[model samples]
Target chain A: MAVFTRGFGGHHPEADRPLPPGQHLTADFPVLSAGPTPNVDAARWELTVRTESGAEHRWDWAGLQAMPAEDVTVDIHCVTRWSKHDTRWRGVPVDAFFEDVETAADFVVAHSYGGYTTNVPLDDLLDGRAWVAYEYEGDPLEPVHGGPVRLLVPHLYFWKSAKWLRGLTLHEHDEPGFWEQNGYHLYGDPWSEQRYS
Target chain B: MNTWHVAQVVAVGRLTSTARTLTLAVPGFAGAVAGQHVDLRLTAPDGYQAVRSYSLARVGRDEVVELAVDRVDDGEVSTYLVDVAEVGDRMEVRGPLGGFFVWHPDDVGPVQLVAGGSGVVPLAAMVRARATSGSPAPFRLLCSVRSPADAFWADELSAPDGVATTWVYTREAPPGVTRPVGRLSAADVDAHVIPPGERARVFVCGPTGFVESAAALLLDAGHDPARIRTERFGGT
Candidate 1:
């Protein structure tokens, strides 16, 4: 993991002015965030899925990691307008996260906490541009920034990196997430300068 | 003080199909400084959450928190707020964030405000504060925009007789426009900003390149770096 240092500001503070307090934390792939850790017992954590065919299945820790995994490095652009260049991750391969495409009904609707949801085209998922990241910067994930496991879709904007991710459902089309449904662009491509319309 | 409240819109609205202003009105809110931000907390149903920071555009007498937002294509939360959040909507928010960049009326330094694009939000606030504070400090603004239509506060922030406003349009010079056409040169900043020196506090905001280049030009002209405050946002 990256070093989380104390301090802030690139210039001088006003007299009697308190120096801005902050941690210079960088995203170290395969590890987790240096911020506060979330409270969720790995043993009690359960992830379930409802297939596009309307079948429900549940799994626990061992069941998830029991699957195969892969590695990837990608850049992320936050809608707030900051771009985190090239982050690396290792996680369950999409091929393992799915069974038959026919079962998914053609799309993937990701379900996360805080009532946030986003949908991805099954083609996008199958195209091998998506995966579930378990290790960042080469270590176990952290909860504060969605550790243990997170849905990391690098090809899209950083917002697609759903933290504290829980489950995925196969859908037939695209659906918006907490930010997407708002006024954000449907396809976030940084090179396109697609800040908005 | 008020239980340190953070907000996230459970629902959102697309007030503008392109750019958006996320309005988080806090009651008796500990208003933000002229230039500061709040980190947005988004808790997904599946339990994944993210905290992204946004700058406060303006802080009026009202306790409302206005975040000037430009929609990022496919930005999960930003999009959610623009396309979804509503008047009754509630979202997690925190802070009167950021320190290096801020302005208040009581401060005695003569001020020069400069901005490009949406970065005008904070500078606009500072200008407003300076105007109302009764501080005899002579203030000037040199803002750059793409065109007349893209100018955020074209009418209000203009100089006398519409000869020129605090803002300059880089794209098209409207007929009868008085400000310089095209990007403002270092000479323009020097000419408009009175007695460019340490007694003047120059603030530059906008795209990272714009802010950096402008600040560099100011420093090159012998302005003390200490008296200059700036905020750099957005870019590749």
Candidate 2:
């Protein structure tokens, strides 16, 4: 048996700064998904916000690009330990998309290609907290990395940012997403370590 | 309640220059199945903590579990487990996690395992379980690595058994191998793996890119998407 004499691996100098509990600073982005990556054609890509009463608000690739887009830099945390700080994204804010719409639903279920689904509170998606981002670091998102478009909800765990996002289904009640249904917490807050139900 | 449990390192063995295998004596271990993984937590003296998940390379009778960790450059927890943590060190762990991506001895038909790099850990556990349980089910493993030196469990996997082992070297092959160094082509997969008509249950584990390619190849080869189970690690 090899005896380890060195102490716990040296800490990052940035360890003193506030970070989500159980997370470590990582310069590399780790890609994790439950299934195969869906290749969505940009021309056919569309994002729809369907209300409970059967109202559909749709945005095609051109329409979404024509909307007001904002560049955001924010810290993103994953349920997994890696945390990448100051990620730059360009997209249409959720508030701008919903500004003219009226919805009585309290929860939103994000639907993605390849049958992935996750639910978020209506409040979390509003107030400039979330975006339907199509670009990362100024390049069009790659397909394997959820290109064309993806939901970016910075306040919650990265899983909340559904990849290959196709539509948002507004619901009157809360429902767990793919991971949430599989033992993850309904509301994943990295700081609170709400990883599991 | 999936809370952290204390695990003491009982032994350590180097598998490769960048990888080490740790044997842990986890008190109250509930006997994890093959292909399941555990989350290990390391806390610094200054109160900072890091957590990472590693597949159980081997599961023993209560109180014992093994994990093979490959140190990723700039990886916080992998560096600790593979290089720093010594025998007798204690760490917090939560697991036997993941019900999917597991194989049971009693499962019907042949089992096909496709692994890339260090993703062989959990599949190795399944191989061990099949041998220990004395199941006669046919098993095949198609592993992709950079070289013979990078492959883990060479001795055990090479042992003659119902499990047919094949290696696809992306960079370098063993001394006398005639095959060129390259990725697993469609022809290689079709020739080495069990045909889809045999109704083999396929489990592929690796980084996202490897898994995506492998699963797509399997689908292209006519395997039912429902029968192919995949588990991806976070890497290029």
Candidate 3:
């Protein structure tokens, strides 16, 4: 065995900015997942929103692309302590998707194709807070980084932005998802460093 | 449950060109099961901290444990552990986290292991446990790497033993071998791994892409999906 000395020091410019606490700037987007990447087929892909009133709104791949979309650049943070700033994405805003829908539910549980679920306040999905983004940096998002379509809620930890998003189930109560049940914070506000229950 | 513990590096050894093994001595350390991982936390002099989990290479009754870290490109914590941390340096670590991915020596029937790159670390622990307990249970390993130079623990894995091992080279094969350099194919897995009919308990560990493809192949081979346990990591 041989001895060695290594330095673990690196500078993060975001640390000096108004970013969240305990997060470092990462120039490259790192892919992190709890399970295998689910490669979904666009021909069969769909996004549905269900409510307690038995109302359902559904959109297939073509239906989603047919609707007007916009490009937005936002900063995103993950629970794993890496934050990528000025990320460019194009998608339909949740506000537009919610136009025809009416519900009394206070909470929304995002469901993914791979059996992953994350709960968020219904208010978080409206008023320009979230989107169902499918394109990244002017191209289709890669499956390894959650493609076909994924929820984009830049306000909270990236986990809340469910990858491979399939539908949204409205509920009167809050429910924890995969990582949330496994010791992750339910609300996951990055600025406050709310990382655990 | 992610509480931090101070661990002193008792020894350091090179496992391969890009990987190194760190033996950390922690006071009052609880024992870990094979396939469980510990989060190694690195804090800079200015107080910035980063944490990455590494699967334990082995489990024992002693307070010290070993973590084989593969130095990844631009990986903050791994670079420190592999290229800079000294034998006497101390760092923060937590747990023996995760219970689902673990394999006990008393587990019955045969065992099938599939690994990609550093994914071999945890599966190696399971293999070592089987060997140490002198269990007669059949064990097989199918490891995928770029080339002979990239393979870890070549000597120990190649030693004649109760475990059957197969190597898949995607970039360059060892001299005198006929298998063309390529990614793991269905035939490679079928030839190397235990068949689904024998009802072998299958454990697959690796990066997201590799795990996805390998598990798909295993499912296509008619292995019981309920019996296959998979753990995935972000490829570096």
Error of 1 at B61 (Å): 4.2
Model 3 stretches with alpha carbons more than 4 Å out: A1-8, A11-19, B28-31, B60-63, B98-111, B129-139, B158-162, B196-202, B207-209, B212-216, B219-236
Q: Write the per-residue lDDT of candidate 2 for residues A4-83, one digit (tens) a residue.
A: 22367555546546888777777767787766666689999998888888888998999998999999998999887778
**Model 1 misplaced regions, further than 4 Å:** A1-197, B1-17, B60-63, B159-165, B178-180
List iRMS for all predictions.
Answer: 18.1, 4.4, 5.5
Model 2: residues with Cα > 4 Å off, grouped in runs? A1-6, A99-102, B104-106, B134-138, B196-201, B219-228, B234-236
Give a tens-digit lDDT track for model 1, residues B25-133: 5655675777766666555444434445677767545456777676656555556655555665554555665554677767876777778777787887776666566
Please report the candidate that would top lDDT against the real structure. Answer: 2
TM-score of each: 0.51, 0.90, 0.85
Candidate achieving higher DockQ, 2 or 3: 2
* C-alpha lDDT score of every prediction, in listed order: 0.60, 0.84, 0.83
TM-score of 2: 0.90
| Shift in Å, residue A5, candidate 3 | 10
DockQ of each: 0.02, 0.30, 0.23
By summed lDDT, the worst window of 10 consecutive residues in model 2 chain A runs over A1-10
For residues B148-192, write the lDDT of model 2, one tens digit per residue.
Answer: 999998878878864899999999999888889988779878989
